[model samples]
Target: MTTILEAKHVNKSYTVHQHEEHQILKDINLLLKQGEFVTIMGPSGSGKSTLLYNISGMDQVSEGSVYFAGEKISALSEKKLSKLRLNKMGFIFQHSHLLKNLNLLDNVLLSAYLAKNSSKEVIGARALRLMKQMGVDGLASHNITQASGGQLQRISICRALINNPDILFGDEPTGALNSSTTAEIMDILHDINAAGTTILLVTHDVRVAARSQRVLFMLDGKLVAERNMGKYNKQQNIRAREAALSDWLTEQGF
Candidate 1:
């Protein structure tokens, strides 16, 4: 598989009170392949989330570089990087962050409208299709407060896909949902990946990481280890996969 994103000897730090350096990511290297589903897992303050933001260009690196689709994103100007992200990347977070004023469907169409690459008729039709694909078409006209957590996340996913991003970056996307709801969301994500979106997620849940094709373990601002668990499908024994991953994570001091 071709490399969709790569971090070469990356390092990141911040200046604390009185010029003290707070190092977050340290000499890390990583990659996400085309059409792959990868997750980063670690304890609190392990730099997993920081790494995600840096590699995706949501934040800049203090040292080294990040490449996305062969472009050196770390070196791009803010304007160019914003344009690149708007055109090629999608993001989801622990919170849905949907606007309070817009209807669900309109919320999903907000970014597409900003991009202004298509007619309203075309974008609206695609919005409805994406909402339906996420099983949220019934709530298209409804306010965000009217839906469950899972439904809101689905709407967020629809919004993320609106511009047909080359890669989807998720930061603990299923963190706020219950187990059953999380499972449902994971199923939706798997189907999306099968349809060809490269996904790189940061998560702590073993069950969530188990569904991914590869899992990267981070510790103390470093990429410590990884596992290639293979493709996921309905017929496979998920519990067994989870158990095996759990054991391996334990070995990683997870």
Candidate 2:
């Protein structure tokens, strides 16, 4: 696989109050290869979401740079960054973020429409195909309010795929779903990754993290440990992973 996403010495900080600073990400580094699925696991307030936001160009970093397909996204103007995000990356959030006024198909196609590079006809066809793969094809015309939470979530995934992004960044994609629905979403994500799309998922769920080929364990806004899941069975790997995590937490006296 080729390198698709790379971040070097990335740092981000937030201003909490007058002359007070909160360091959310501290000299972070990351590299993602094509067709690889990597999950980031961290406790609350550990900067998992902040890392995702910075890497995905949703927010500017305080320092360092992120390279996507040989382009430095950190240097792009806001307009160009928006284009890069819309055309090259797919995002699935905890909430589906679908428009209430539009049906499933319309919601998906609307992204392409706003991006200004793809045709509605092409986007609509691709969106339908993705929804069909997710088993939500029968509800293409249904509004989000009319759909079940699981259906809406699947539709969000389909929307993300409509543009055939170079990478998929999911921030707790399964966080709001029941176990069964979460499992379904996980299976879908696995299938999508198997089909050669690079994926970066930030999740607190152990089961979700175990599904990835690599797990990056973060603490206090830093990547303190990493586990290669390719070396062990899923159950054993998760147990070991959790054990290591426990050790880290215990060391911190938490």
The TM-score leader among the candidates is 1
Candidate 2 Cα errors over 4 Å, as ranges: 231-254
TM-score attained by model 2: 0.91
- The deviation in Å at residue 17 for candidate 2 is 1.6
lDDT of 1 at 155: 96
Task: Encode model 1's per-residue lDDT on 107-182: one tens digit a residue.
Answer: 9999999888899999999999999888999999999999999999999999999999999999999999999999
Residues 160-183, candidate 2, lDDT per residue (tens digit)?
A: 988788899999999999988987
TM-score of each: 0.98, 0.91
lDDT of each: 0.94, 0.85
Error of 1 at 57 (Å): 0.6
